[model samples]
Target: MRREIIDYLKFLMGAPFIKGYRLIGETHLHIQYYSEFEEFKSDHPMSEYTKEEFDQYFNENDTLKKLLVGESVRLLRQFSYLECVTIEIKSYDRVVVEVHSSRFILNKYFGFNIEDLSLGDNTWKSMFVDVYLADPAKRNELYEKIVCKFNQ
Candidate 1:
């Protein structure tokens, strides 16, 4: 199930996702990546929001959700690399929620991109669906937002 879920999440990345980065999710419950949005990372916004807080903000903001769900997600193409990412079930109906992984845990234990290094001189980044979203639902709800060409 873990591999299957990862495949599905990777599918969200489609042909645009570069090798090395990972997609973490479970069925239809949660999905996310560990990259910074180019817009946010451009000036180095230094997000004041933690994973939970950032998730809550996106879940509650309709405008932001709309932006993500519609035809404006192309802005993700500006980032060089996504440092750390994880997806969790805020509320899942099918399976019992137990061991959803945390970005902090992945970063601390598994060394999930702590150095913030880019894959290859920032030629093509993998900040696809996983990095652009906070709430997993927003990702599912916003598939149309993807507009980045996978030419790199």
Candidate 2:
């Protein structure tokens, strides 16, 4: 998943000014992106997925559904049900306009019961998945920067 995320990020950072993006640590998840584009910089706004929205993410797609035959979504959804959106959206960022984020963390396999999650207290694991998080305005600003960087 990490490799896939990086590959996708690299593919999206096709802007010319972007020298490249590198990994950063200390925080839960971090990546440093270098850009020759004059507008590029370290400051960019990032976003987060609310608790309810995160729950919906898992409810829509359940891993157990993979066990079904033919792999059709209909067949998968017939039996399996999502108690909660197990994936906790810790953070997300947008790399370039239209493209995905630079870094974020999502936690999967949350909750206690398969049918329903623990309402009061549930444990979750932090998953450093692919993607970035940024507000639309920030994303546009970043996108413009990427375009400028690439165009130069």
Candidate 3:
């Protein structure tokens, strides 16, 4: 699972930038890429409409909405930023992704029942994994390591 997670992180490194991620439920995370669409800024015709009116117009106009969605997709694909990856894992106790100045860390925990079941024997084996972002100078030091890996 660690290797699989690493591979996924490596795959994400191909993108120009990671826009952000949305956590759906406890086990699924969707990571989006930063797109040129986000950088598009102009005092154009579209800017004339108020935010509420713009949303209402788009909501009412199916054809226009589809056209805009298609165009946004086209632009994202053109820049190779179209792909969004969803990471799903089961029985994960906790997953921590820490981003520091130079690197990031991906930590995955498993086997501990955060919510204990009714069964008498609730004790279970646990596993803790760490992906360090910064090189440790001391034996106990841990730092962010993944962001640097992505940046490289």
User: Best candidate, lDDT-wise?
Assistant: 1
Worst 10 residues of 1 by lDDT: 88-97
Query: For residues 102-130, what per-residue lDDT tens digits would candidate 2 score against the true structure?
Result: 11110122112222312233311111011
How many clashes does the backbone of model 3 have?
A: 7
lDDT of 3 by residue, 1-152 (tens): 22343344444331223344553443333544322222211223343334444333223333222222222222222223223223211112222122221101111121222233122442211111111111123111322121111221
TM-score for each model: 0.21, 0.20, 0.20
After the best TM-score superposition of candidate 3, give how far the Cα of residue 29 lies from its true spot, in angstroms: 1.7
Query: lDDT of each structure?
Result: 0.32, 0.23, 0.27
Best by TM-score: 1
- What is candidate 1's lDDT per residue for 78-98, written digit by digit as tens? 221322222211221222111
Give the candidates in order of TM-score, highest first.
1, 3, 2
Q: How should the candidates be ordered by lDDT, best one leading?
A: 1, 3, 2
> Which of the two, 1 or 2, has more lDDT?
1
RMSD in angstroms, candidate 1?
16.5
